[model samples]
Target chain A: MIQMFHVTKAYPGDPPVLVDINLDIDKGEFVFLTGPSGAGKSTLLKLMFLAERATRGQVLLAGRNVARLRESGIPFLRRNIGVVFQDFKLLPTRTVAENVGFTLDVLGTPRDEVRDRSLKMLRRVGLEHKADVSPLKLSGGEQQRVSLARALVNDPALLLADEPTGNLDPALTVEIMDLLTDVNARGTTIVVATHDATLIERYQKRTLRLEKGTVVADERGAKAARLMSQTA
Target chain B: MSVASKLAYFGRTAIGSIVRSPFVHVIAVASLSLALVGFGVARIARAQLDALVDALGGEVELTVYLAEDAAPEQVAELEQALTQRTGGEVHRISPAEALGRLATQLGEDGKALTELPQNPLPWSLEVRLPKAARDAEALGELSRRTRALPFVTGVDYGEEALVRLGLIARALEVASLVVFSLVFLTAVIVVSATLQLAIFARREEIEIQKLVGATDRFVRVPFLLEGLLQGLLASGLALGALVGLVRWLESSAAGPLAFARLDGQLAVEWPRLAGELVGIGCALGLSGSFIAVRRFLRV
Candidate 1:
């Protein structure tokens, strides 16, 4: 679950990047945060994950008031939220499996369990055969999937993605979206930030469109439920 | 992860970082080792000098010569004063005894009839000072006091030799201080600079780790470990080199420099010296990496 109450974010000497935004999403929902470039979508996701703080108002992610969270509590809070970047922020020096297991490793998980869970996640992402290979050796799509496996390896309750498929071909984009849909079916809430209008129309999900720094439209796609269920 | 697993990860990461950037690591290690070797050599030299000073100091005795025409009572009074001042034995050498000592020193040329119309050697008191009173300053003070006595003609205690030895000791102390300070500073700079480059190379890795919920401590431990390993390796190399150097000196030159030996061996405390060097190396490594991590790894 995610909630934002009139959240405003701004940088010094610049106009607000996000202004007076208020929204709510329940558990297990897959939402598309659609907007053009520079519409503050990434900033919103960052605020949800505590990567950036709101200049004003409050953000509640997974029942915790992120605005009031202590600095030392940030990591534990982050453990409950998974985030994927447009660039697929995978370490080139690490094997694909190692990259996926990194989350659990930070949690101080046992090596055996980390290996087992990461390998299982790699299988889920259809990258099991590439587990031992360096992420640098993978294609763009494969790397993105590796990144996805890493994000979801710990089974975080909330997954925030910023242009998750931005670097992928149309076919690869569908592949990543299908994986996301399956994750949502297993009870993880998902928020995806993107500027791809075609995805907005094709995915048929609850779409919130942004312009400048404000949300201009909130459209709950009529066929979203049927499409997501069919895909799952 | 268990504590053991965490430590293993940190160790592996540290080793990997070092191997990945061998040039900078090697440079850092070599510089630190050379600095430590300089320190160790200085310590050994100082120890040898201290032993030599102690040996010479123990034998130092003051010879107080009486006035040529002083009476017997004057001689006895001077003897009592010298004994009280030095708090040790004061043996009186009569004119006859002094002459005999000179004759024996002449070594078979003694038939020259004591070398003069009359026995030339004066009555003297050999003042044996306590161990604490053998330093140059104390001996000089006692000599000045003795020379002011009415019956005393001269007080000689090899003052020049003692003064020179004192100067050498002081100079060695200052030199050790300067060497240690410079070496420590150089090692810290080398390590921190090397670690800074490693940090830059791993910036992406750091960013991802933080993004995925790694703590600041988690990000920092590996760099600190890397610095610690560098320091340890440098110290090990320094110790090895110092041992080899001492062995070489002993085998090839100990016979020529017999006085440098202490109880048939060098006076170096190998275990304590090794422990100190290792401790210093660990400190240098920890501090250097701490600085680098605090500045560069802003997570």
Candidate 2:
């Protein structure tokens, strides 16, 4: 679960990126953060992951205020949160299996177990056949699946994907979204930040729309239709 | 994870990095070998210089010749004084003994010495000082003290040769230190620069590792291992090259090198030298990797 009461984030000599944001995301929930470029959707997810700190107010995760967490505590906190990037930050030199198993490797899981679990996760993403191939040789969608496998390998409680389908075509984007939905169905809280209104309209999940450093709307499932209508 | 598993992981990752970029590893190892070779050669030369100094020091002695008409009691007094002052053996050579030695030195032309009207050789006390007093300054001081003794006519010591040898030894020691420092600096810089390139090549991997919740130590251990492996390989290569070089010097056109003729083998202690070289290589590698990885870890 997460909570942010009056959180404000700013860089030096610049206007506040996220101003007076008040929000709450409950456990096992799948939330979509939709905003235009420079609208602070990624910044909000970064704060939740403790990758960034709020200049004012507290941001709480799992009932603990992460803004007060020490730097040394960040990694342990991140262990419970999986992040997938738009560019698919897989190590090019590593095989797909190695890329997927990296999270377990960081946790120092037993070698056989790491291999087994990584293979299983790759299978779930339907990329087990490509495990031994280099990420460089995989298609963008396949690489993104490997990234998803890596994120879910450790069974983290929360998943944050910043435009996970940004580089994919419509078909691949749907596949990625379905995989994310499957992960969410397995009881992992998910927050995906993207500007894709089509995916948002199609998914019909709870969408928090941001504009000018403020949450302009918080719509759920059917209510999301009204917000999209207003935007149009 | 258990320590063993962690180490295993680190080792595999390090070796994987090296395998992925053979050119970088090769360049690093070659540069390290060059630096280590310079240090190895300098160490051997220093050992040889020390041996030479020891050989020359062992041969140093002072001969205090008594006055031609000196009385027996005065000669005995001078001998006793020298023995007490130097804490060394003082052998008294009588006129007969002195003439006998002179005749032996003359070899084939000694027939005229036996027909002389009277013995002209003066009695002398051969003063053999300890090794500590064999240097130029110490021997000079000892000679000055002996010449002022009663019944002592003159003192003959290898002053010029001892002084020259001492100067050479001192200069060689300074040169060895300078060479060692220069080589060490060069090794560190080259290793650091090479590791910097290696780290840059793997920056994406490092960033991925960090994002996946890998501890800083977990990320750092692989680079450290990489540096360590480079250093170890470099050291082995340098040692092999050094042994080959020494063997070549021994069998070269000029005949066996004087230093390599130490009891029919090279003067350097192979095992100890190898150990030291490897230790230095490891240190250089560790430091280089540590420095190069620091800026990247900030992310």
Top candidate (lDDT): 2
Interface RMSD of each: 1.5, 1.1
lDDT digits (tens) for residues A63-108 of candidate 2 = 8888677767778888899998777889888889988889999998
- Give the chain A TM-score for each candidate: 0.92, 0.94
Alpha carbon deviation, residue A225, candidate 2 (Å)? 3.3
Displacement of the residue B34 alpha carbon in candidate 1, Å? 3.7
lDDT of 1 by residue, B69-140 (tens): 888888787778777777778898988998888778887897685657888778888976665666788778
Shift of residue A184 alpha carbon in model 1, Å? 1.4
Q: What's the lDDT for residue B134 in model 1?
A: 67
Alpha-carbon RMSD, each predicted model:
5.1, 3.6
Give the Å error, residue B32, model 2. Answer: 1.3
Best by TM-score: 2
Q: How does model 1 do on interface RMSD, in angstroms?
A: 1.5
